[model samples]
Target: MAIKITGFYQLPHQTMPELVDFDEVFDTSFMRKYTRFRTFEKFLQGSRLKIENQRDFEALPEEKMDAWVRKATKFSSWQEMLDTATDKYVMHKNM
Candidate 1:
């Protein structure tokens, strides 16, 4: 008999990417548009990509928005958001 593994599996921790260092690399001027950022310095210390203001992110240029989307989807715990087809679908399901 042959055995097959399927369903859910916990990936080894080594497969995970390292956390990004926002302070060292994030562009404050670019990031500021994603919020009413009181101060660029303060924003880095407090902002969580998962909690960004959608309207503010939308106001940014296409390239910037794409970067944010990639960052949030690829690095954050809410990675499943990237797997979905569209924002409207996500909204519809939420409703």
Candidate 2:
């Protein structure tokens, strides 16, 4: 289940497990959208898919990039991920 964080932009410190490139993120494979992709590359891919134009993925809008990333991943949004993210330094935390 996803947790709803109120404030403190500090996510639970989770790891981006299914990080992928822009090409793969929007390569006619909707599966990528459900994956936990990170970086501006994947975010750009998602945004491109939404716009469906010749716009340079690299130059995609920066404002909504985070939203695009959240839609492609399992988290509700960047804010949610940031709030409920689990720490990586302590691998034993999940153990």
Candidate 3:
């Protein structure tokens, strides 16, 4: 079977976003285990910000996006969310 998986990553000092590929099984399992949303798209929708796609989501003001994330998720900021997600992904991968 062929599987495709992709995600975005940004470092603390980086101005550019990086595209990263993940294992399909691991990604699906991680999301199911850790987050309320089944997929990142659902997570964005949970913000109730009318984000139809990555472009729409990117066009949102940073402050507004951060506010929505904070309200919708337990993380206080987007970076925190990313950090936690990364940490959990690695932890699960090691198990």
Most accurate candidate by TM-score: 3
TM-score of model 1 vs. true structure: 0.23
Q: Whose lDDT is higher: candidate 2's or candidate 3's?
A: 3
Local error of candidate 3 at residue 5 (angstroms): 10
Q: Per-residue alpha-carbon lDDT of model 3 for 1-95, expressed as tens digits? A: 12234567554446986676544323655556655767665666577776665556567787887797677666687767666777666565457
Clashing pairs in 2: 11-82, 12-85, 12-86, 13-85, 13-86, 14-86
Stretches off by above 4 angstroms in model 3 are: 1-18, 21-35, 90-95
lDDT of 1 by residue, 1-95 (tens): 11121122122333554332333222343345434443334542243333244344334365543554555333222223222322333343346
Name the candidate, 1 or 3, with the larger lDDT value. 3
Clashing pairs in 1: none
Q: Using Cα atoms with residue i matched to residue i, what is each candidate's TM-score against the true structure? A: 0.23, 0.29, 0.56
Q: What CA RMSD would you report for each candidate?
A: 18.0, 11.6, 6.2
lDDT of 2: 0.40
Order of candidates by TM-score, top first? 3, 2, 1
Cα lDDT listed for each candidate? 0.35, 0.40, 0.62
lDDT of 2 by residue, 1-95 (tens): 11111212222454444332323223333334345544333444445545433343334464565666566667666445433332221232345
What order do candidates take by lDDT, descending?
Answer: 3, 2, 1
Clashes of each: 0, 6, 0
